[model samples]
Target: MAMGMASSGRRRGNRTRRAAMAEINVTPLVDVMLVLLIIFMVTVTLPAVGVPIELPESRANPVEELPDQVNISVDNAGRIYLENDPVAPGGFADALATIRRNDGEQPVIVLRGDTGLDYGRVMAVMGELNRAGFKSISLVTDGSDTAP
Candidate 1:
């Protein structure tokens, strides 16, 4: 009876060891899932939201070398200016055509509309750019504060 009791105790010890090890073994699985999640998050780039206006304040970090930028400004009155030169409403297409003729590579069109202008007006300009086949377009803003 003493020997039988000892053997049963040894079997219980082995079962306990196996039960402790069978805890789903989730540590390695969790590590792998976390790594894949990080990889996907890093690879994805979120689209820019809103009207691309009302840019927040930031310290100036001017690039030493940058490509030539074509400036397009829209005033509060909705007048469009192409690089300091006033462009008539009917002349926008012509101006864009000229730019394309000058440079086959699409010039980076920087749209700078007045803050007081309607949001729809800004979107209209973006639509025109898309129609004109301008692939690279950006919105420009002034970093100055008028509160003073």
Candidate 2:
């Protein structure tokens, strides 16, 4: 009879031990957090240029970035994209006008052209921008530490 009581007491103690083992495992949580950190770092480095274009390399110094800057990208197909949105060839001027009116200030234009794109295509876009009276135009290109 005493042995039976002692065994019941041991069963209660085992139940308490089982309850204590229900602690949250931090190892899996830490692994998930680390994975999220890596994902964020990879995504942040992507270019804000809107379109994926291979920019020509240049040794020229980079221009100062402006908060009110508009990115213009010309793809290899000669498609013009204003701030990542496709702008029709004929409506390019109207788009520029609308931006100026909405911003109430002259926004700096940063032009990015694909390396394989013809020079004439890039110049044509620049000419139109010039006609729009955008005095601040900056060309974006990939740059290296060592100048060629």
Candidate 3:
């Protein structure tokens, strides 16, 4: 009877069991999501856009003294002023030619465009200056104000 019981036990052991399956684990997925969240939190505090333009205050810094510069002011009306003298749009080329002739060393052209003026107008002035052979052009800003 003992030998018969042992034979039955051996037969049960001979039966094959199903193999364990290999599958993608989700532990690494959770870790990756946490790391990405930390990275975003650390870098999200920086300023995206620059400050806007406003009028200069009384406490603004004094203008630094530089060599003689040719002042060109563009008002809101799209009118051009050269050294406080009003210059017509048609006379721009002729006036620039005269300035070029008088300047011994390439004179610095300082452009002071009003905040209310159109940006295209400013660009047009720059284009005119470039065509007139004026290479040293400096944009004059109030420095007290930021662009809106």
Candidate 4:
């Protein structure tokens, strides 16, 4: 009887069909994401522009610098410098348009106006920035505490 049952079990096992595995594995995807994260972290660059200015002392907190923010500086003489290069009033539109084209999004600007610069000059520069499609503006000032 045992031999007869063993022969029947073999026949049933050979005749049965199993379904194929269809689930996706995510280990590779997670590995790629981690690599990309590390790459971005290691490639971070510091913001440095040698354009000198006497910044006004302020009690307000400083704004965090982002990787993509455009830097514009105004001198006491009311001359405008874009990314450390002098920008002419006649070519202002073209210079801003080029930046806008490269960024391809709503732009943000960090303006470092000299402490001795005229208020009207700063305002005029701000207005031009607004008209050139960079609506977000930030003034860079030195954080200070009154000390004897």
TM-scores for all predictions: 0.51, 0.68, 0.52, 0.62
Q: For this target, which candidate reaches the highest TM-score against the unseen true structure?
A: 2
Q: Pick the candidate with the highest lDDT.
A: 2
**Cα error of candidate 2 at position 9, Å:** 13
Instruction: Give the alpha-carbon lDDT of every model.
Output: 0.67, 0.83, 0.69, 0.79
Q: Which is the winner by TM-score between candidate 2 and candidate 4?
A: 2
Q: After superposition, how far is residue 130 of candidate 3 from its true place, in Å?
A: 0.4
Tens digits of per-residue lDDT, candidate 4, 1-148, equal: 3555443233454484445657989999999999999999888854456688888888878777877878899888887888989998777767777784344666569899999998998998888888887878888988789732
Off by over 4 Å in 1: 1-67, 101-103, 144-148
Better of 1 and 3 by lDDT: 3
Instruction: Write the candidate numbers in order of decreasing TM-score.
Output: 2, 4, 3, 1
Which residue ranges in model 3 land beyond 4 Å of their true spot? 1-63, 100-103, 145-148
Q: Per-residue CA lDDT of candidate 3, range 31-82, in tens?
A: 9999999999997754221223232233345454345667777776777878
User: Which is the winner by lDDT between candidate 2 and candidate 3?
Assistant: 2
